[model samples]
Target: MNASRHLLPVLVLLLVTQWAAAQINDTLPAVVEPQVDNNRVKFTSQLRPLRGVAGAPAPFYTYFWEFGDGTYSFEKEPVHLYKDTGDYPVRLWATNNYDDGKKPPTRLKKIKVEKKTMLAANTPPAFFKGGGSLEMITNQMPRPGEDMVLLLGYRNKPGSHTATVSGSVMLLYNEKQFGQNSFDLAEARSYHQEKKIGLDSLLAYAPAEEWNMPLQGTLTGEADSRGGGLFTASGGGNLPIAGKPQLKAFLKEQMEGYRQHHIWRINEVKQGEEQFMFLSLNTLPEMIKDTNAVVTISGLFIPDDPSMDVERFALDLQIVASHDPNRIMLKNRRLNYRFTGKNRENIYKVQFQNTGKGPAKRVAITVTIPGMLNTGTVELVDMKPACTWCDSAYANQSCIDTILTKDSIQFIFKNIYLPGTQQEGISDPDSTMGYVRYKLRFTKKMKKMPFTSRASIVFDKNEPIYTNRSVGRFKKGLSPGIIIGYNTIPGKKPQDILPQNYVLGFTLSEYAAYKKYFQWEIYLEKSRSYESYDGRRIGGDTMINGVGYKVEYRDQYRQQKVLSLEAVPVHFRYNINSYMAAGAGALVGVDVERSVTPVVETWIQRPNGQGLALMKGAYEKQLESFANWRGAFFADFQLGIVRAGPAAGIRFLQYINPSHQRIFLYASWKL
Candidate 1:
């Protein structure tokens, strides 16, 4: 009877196991499908990128999306835009780990995009062209007797009739004026050139004539209307000349006078060695402000022609810049910085401005103050800088600090924005308000005598502007200088890089030799407070792994006020240029530290167990010995007054780590 009972229990257990196996098999299929937001075709009239949305459910599943255009996405909800116009098939594959982790059946979608075109059937053809002062592509300023290239833009209605076009260009300055016709002697010359005629002899024989300068002048012109039938078959092109001979031949004397002062010319681009057909253009003398150049063109059509003229307009521009004195201005408000000795409160402000008609972009302002190292003589502007004539007109207002070129301070501001006329009372005077201000002091003498300062403004889009100089004469004088700086250590303990956090130091230097000599004599450093070599906690409370307990590391050192002395055996330098210097020399030093107890410390919670901060117990250890007397192969480079490179030394109780030798990178100063 006992054996039968045991057999019955075993049979039941076997049956239960079989049923559980069957249930697992039924749920193992793991069939999942991927979906998306938009699967319908759409049309756009532009050749721009397109974006699609994926609406796939996930979390337990990994998604992979294949965009038809050779791009793929692994995101659960992928979004893509096609920059090209075409038909693309997108597919998605999703896999979940619940089963064998194999990709499920792919989800495919089809999308079609329409072709893109720049012109629509309903929109008329347009033209956009001109020169400086005019919004066009040429980045140039015209010079006296220079041939000014006038840009021509053209586009016509697709089904326009053929037509003939001409233009009349004129330079009008009050009573003084110059004008030209489409079919003039210049045009005849171009016509002769097409037949391979050499006009060198004719041109040389041309008499020299004086140019008339009007008190007030204006420039005017146009093009699309001057488009001949040639543009209708394709598109319009730029022409140098565009005028008709309308004034009667009886006015030949006046025309001759105008022709003598101003002439028409043609410019051509070349492919390989083949020169392109000459494009009609105009030549003008470098006229000053109040003078304007004018142009006018017309499009004429005949019945039954496939192309016709449909526009007419005029272009006029007033010349404002001059070849002699460009529009940039500079001045130093402090005038001449007079000093009695090697040191002085060399304080001043420099102002720069763009007085031209256009905004200056990518302006590089360089201020050269020879004989000054940024580290010593240059102090932080102290507080927020004062601006007498600026209100966010310029972006990137920060200075480049010590620019290495010629001991100069340089920085570049992008897009010096000019307010439009619509902007309130800011007229020409208000425009002069943008200038740079710097305040500094010089405590040490320079390698050369007589301090001379000058500034320059460079532009990426225009000619550079220069400032007049301020020269300072030396008097038998002297004054003190101050400098504060920082350097950081990388290690398991005290991982801080703040100037105050790493080092607090003071250095005094003197100009001992001729005007060509200077040396750093005294240096003092104070160690900053830091947690023990461990970071888990600071002060009385610290951290422990996997536990809610506290431990603390304390800051300690013996005779912490460490001092050092340096001598200048042979001081020399290699000049890379008028603006940069490189130098190296042997320096030996002895660390001064009084005998005292050196300790490592920690803290623990008190027996009262009140609060971590309320009660504490302190622990410390005294070291057996510490090494001293250290120095290394040191190299120094001066970019103007800015310095860089590595160094080595020793501190009391702790020999300066050779690895930490780079701290000198933050230790140089000129004053």
Candidate 2:
């Protein structure tokens, strides 16, 4: 019974242990609660409440803060100063320890700090009108990058106007800013007043840095009309002015609108003798009427002493027409004239008017005649009535003398003229007809004479010449002539190549009675030759008789060879006056038996050779047939006439083999 009781205790212990293990493995329910607002933390507050768990304790705690001046702070609840004027952020955190036995204890809530509010003073100063100048006072000159406070005082009639007035203060600077405590203004000042403001003090932060000082307030106040006051003071530095000559020149050249009426002059000289100048721009309409003027000071004048720098001072003036009242009239009246003549002596007359509103003075005229004159002489003449003040005369009889006046000026010219020419008779004909040209210019001041007008003229002559000629010959007639010639075949054995023999031919012309050194000819010729080559001697006579026509064009001559297909044993000949010619024709000749025997008997004994020998023999027999057709093509070069009367040439002849489909050289002409 005691053992049984012990066993029950052991069973109960096991059950308890198993239950504990089950409880350890089980998960706790998730907490459902509101979270803390981390952005709502207030300044001066100690602890912040976080959201996400209402009944649960804080799980974790953290802090954060933001100052309006581009800075941040992190703490449960942070306190910080905004070094400058701006907004700031505040944050916080909460810690909580959860007691669930199944999981680890964790801090769960996080909160945010709220943005802080700041107060700003935007009120302006009140203005007062009085006889005395209103003074603005400050504790010290404004530092380079710091704000300054200004005390503005205004005085007026008692109860004459409202005592309270409001305005804004503006800060002007030469540079920009970075953060609240950082800026680029090296020197700064303060200014304030009812009617005027001035630089109170000059504060320098760093020598290399720049500063932006502010003008304080939109100053407002009432002022008595009798005692109204105004004050002026210098800023950190003097205002910029045009001090350099290059800058002045650039301004004068580029600033067209202000150039005409503005004049810059040296008004005074300083202790070092440096000239001080000021610019005066005319604002009146009449001063700049119809004139666009620019004056640039190119140089300066110093007192002329060896020791002093001052000397003769002069400004270069470049005057340009800016506005033209008669622009349309001038554009419409613009004229260009062209004069053409056969000779340089031909007079060219041109008349031109201003056709504009401006007057032309000291006009000049010049004449240039081309040197290509057949006769090497020329003269110029002016055709105007004689005047006492302006008269010019030419000594040459061909030239005329006259005077120039305001109304009109006439120019006359005379000279012997020549032009480029060709060969006298054969190729060209000569003639003389050329051109003259002129131009005029006007000057206000001349080095030799004042208020004079001048003109410039250029004349060139071109004479025409014929480049070719045309002639006529008798149209129809006939003439005959004989030519005796010898022919030799080309290559080693010249004597064996051809029987050295003579050739006789006849020539005919279109005219019979009009025989002269120069003549046109159409002819027919008949010739014969005997030729041989190698050890085989073959002689056959050939006759060539054909009618041909020729035409002489320029330096070149062309002739066509005419042949009748029915004419057998004849070769056609075509000749150009040049050394070379090309021809195509046919030749008919009977093969003549020579003293050499047939060589086919040497190969007749073999079984297959007999058939080959018979075929060769047949070929030889067919080649001997007189009725076989033979075509010839040739290119020939005339070397010279042999022994004077008969012409000879080297000809390359391609004769078609009737039996074998091959080309062979049948003959060649040798002088």
Candidate 3:
């Protein structure tokens, strides 16, 4: 028995060696990323493919359209003009081919058209954002291998600069996640919808359904495991499989789905004299096999740095040395597989454990899918039957992403917290281990056959990656789970609530002075701007209606200066938009000069429109003798804080005369 067991590993090794030799890979096909016009509205329109995928062939593409304005265009990008202003719903369906009554991918959105007369105005300080220099510490160019850490350094630029840097790093189609975990991998490997899925399809997983939209993007870099994938356990690191032969056989089978790449948005940067951002890159394990692939990084500022005149910053790096992937080990925590519910209701459950020395931060498990043993397996719900249920006691739904393809789907589980860190690794029950359970559709059609499957795993701690694959046959069955990545139905979706948003600001307004009104007067101003979640933009009060205010100096004829205080009871501002606002309010004040102002005014324009002399002593005596008051009903027109307003009402004893209305029109600056 011992001899037979030992020989099995050797036998498995030989078979894998033979298989790798028989496999073939010559040339990789191109990718297609279609770009159609996505605007609210346009007078003239244009459509084309991005990069160099254009000019392929018209017959290969099929276009469908719904202009919403009772019109349609079958062209790539259709140009249409609307006779009136209204929201128009637009839809476009683009397909490389229309095969077997299949629906193509499409884009849908509403276009807005506006027709209104607008006046141009020069304004400033409505909104603000600033500048800083960003330095990245990564490969000027990088080669495919282990996941890498990127260091971002930022500093404010000279002279009146903003201290933050916000942007994104775009990696195009270069990112490929494992796809179709439940579909028959073994069948997919051998069967083709049309021309056979070449051996290249193994390393390069583009099922027949994806031929219309090939993976055509420039590949800059990828992640890969180094060294043999070690299985870390309480007893110390050991081979995950029973023997080396099994290990070899697993690696060979994994050769089919070897790929790596994970790049997403860069986070926002806070203002400071200097700041650093650390980024962890997720890549494919297959990339390590290639010793000569370079990786690149690209970054562009948010809202765009209109001043730079440059589009983005790019850096690339190359790989140097590699290590054994087996350094950190991850395996089925439990050593078995089982199934329940026959026909379209079979559930498969598998658990993996880490029996190695290192802790893996990211773990990707690719479950092999076998071709339908029974044609009775007709209806396919949510492509990856394995991912139908993403949450269970063993698996956390928050950390999974699944990508589905015609034949296979891959479940990407990330941020795995194992027992180990830079210093030590985890121990018993810490679960250097985890499990996955899923349900796939299958039924015994004619001949009963043993259920079978093959799977591969890729994991790492940013360096010296680890990977392994295993094949299992069902003398039994198993349980299930869901995804951490990919845009497929039955996949995990984002479940987060947005925070409340609103702007709070302060504004001060100083209107007009009194020398010109032949009396002593006061002047001041106010205004501010911001928006709220309710779609309302509230701002500081705007001086509209132009009943302007004026600057009045102490008149030469009157001497004594008055002491007084002002209280404003009502004030309100209206936001027309981001640029304009109108304001109205009522004001009242107590000024020693208020009571004397009408007397001075009466003395100056004596009902005859001629100057009338008044003594300074008489003004002072009367100012102190009676109760003083001032009030106004004002209207203002404002462009920014520069305001123009007109206010009219009574002053001093002038309130005693019902029709005594003196209007002041003025413009002034405010803080």
Candidate 4:
């Protein structure tokens, strides 16, 4: 029986280990199944069945296929026709939505086209017609410990009608505001003869008057309808144009906001011609764990021509647990608790894609509005498949209409044509996607708690496809507090010779947490006491064999000073309201320094028998010690503002070994 008891736990652990290994093996990467005919190839994927997540939509797979010839598609089984006969490498990313398992792994395959059967007449159109002079887009959202590709598209549009230009492009990542790096640049691929350069070399190309203000305004002040700015509250901000502050000034400003950056020097770019650069960024394993959080990667485009104005662009991507095309996001998911209040504006974006095999004439999106937000303040900031607002004058043209309920908002795209990803003759994946962005303000006196919202997308009369929940959380800010207290031992009267104890300390805890939080504290305490004792006289006025009687006496006085380093290692607190709170925790302390001074006097009677007393000995001594350990348990109550600012409280502490207790009256201010 004893042997079996000892072996049972080990057997159970082994079983668990095997089960976990089996679970991991069940989620292998998808296999690429390709069929080829001359230059035309049809690709299919065989993916492991998804393990569905509880309470989530039905499990499904989303595909992102990259053809070797600088082209890609979002179709499940894309059929491509190669114009040139060469070896092409193809890759696929199979995203399992509503699945409990990790995303399926992918393998790159090299497809060789030896014979050409058809003409290359249906070439895709060129980019940079509408995506501004400098723009960026990512293949997919970032997943921790995974890799993602960012494509930077730039054009030579130096307004002076210059035929050719040479300039540099910079990619900035890993915002310094976050404590840990979110991404590391693994590789950068450039087809053009772009050379990597240092920061100083890039700054050397700046124009004169570097400190002048930009023609474009600040990115943090308002939401940009163009969706190309450092998004703070809303989804967009002004994409700045360095009209006056030259290229060097902009680079200096960007350096302060980002932790790491990479610059590339372009030798030449012809007018109206566009160039592309692809960066492979590996999401660091220690990236921030907020799955719904958003991280930004900014870019700058500078022309060597002194007259050309520099341009800036930014792209925001959410850190996702899984890649899902239909999703909603708050651009600024983590907010400062101090500034989040009424009149604070926030932007919410809903994105939907058509996955069916045909186009939809109408699409409707309904979103749940968190109670703390004021729905009356909703304003459309931007949208794709851009259309005008519905009016009486727009019955025939395509337009968007809004309907508001008490707790939800619905946006209907009417008389519109949105192509499906699997639709025939569709080559551009971007053409099948749509999004709606709107801004809202917080209600007055909202609670400082996290909020979430999701969207339900409908294509014509089909079932609603639910998106992921977008959460808005306040950054767990730090609150530093100062404590001053005076403590007295319990069961001690005014005249009972009590030690004088005074405490001065500091505390650290979550800043104004909604209800409950833990705190850690350390303090210095000084305790002083005085002690004295006297022995009664003995052998007084006694004589033996004609000798005087001898008497011995002793008296002593001592003063002690104890300086202790006190700490609270485990403290749990709960705030009942804005002004009242309670807490309980264990406190530990050690006397770092201690000192004691003693005065002793001894008296002896003379032998004359006449009782003549004289002092025989007198001495003063000092005693010292280090590291006297002690511990106590304390429960405290507070009055006044418990979250921030000033507060006063009293704590009761009971010592474990000595069976002594103390009461402390303290005042604190949390800042």
Scored by lDDT, the top model is 4
Clash total of candidate 1 = 43
TM-score of 3: 0.17
**Evaluation by TM-score, superior candidate among 1 and 3:** 1
Where does candidate 1 stray beyond 4 Å?
Answer: 1-343, 372-406, 419-428, 443-448, 476-671
Using all chains and alpha carbons, the TM-scores for the candidates as numbered come to 0.20, 0.16, 0.17, 0.80
350-438 in candidate 4: lDDT tens per residue? 88778778998889999998898888889988787788887743566888999998678999988889997678887666677788888
Off by over 4 Å in 3: 1-344, 355-358, 373-398, 421-425, 443-447, 461-671
For candidate 3, the 10 contiguous residues with the lowest summed lDDT are 183-192
Deviation from native of the Cα of residue 572 in model 1, angstroms:
30
**Preferred candidate (lDDT higher): 1 or 3:** 1
> lDDT of model 1 at residue 460?
53
| Candidate 2 Cα outliers beyond 4 Å, as residue runs | 1-396, 399-492, 497-502, 506-630, 639-648, 657-671
Model 4 TM-score (2 dp): 0.80
How does model 2 score by TM-score? 0.16
| Ten contiguous residues minimizing lDDT sum, candidate 4 | 226-235
Instruction: Tell me the alpha-carbon RMSD of every candidate.
Output: 32.4, 44.1, 35.5, 7.2
For model 3 the local lDDT of residue 365 reads: 58
Encode model 2's per-residue lDDT on 594-660: one tens digit a residue: 1222222112222433441211221121122223344544444443322112334444544555532
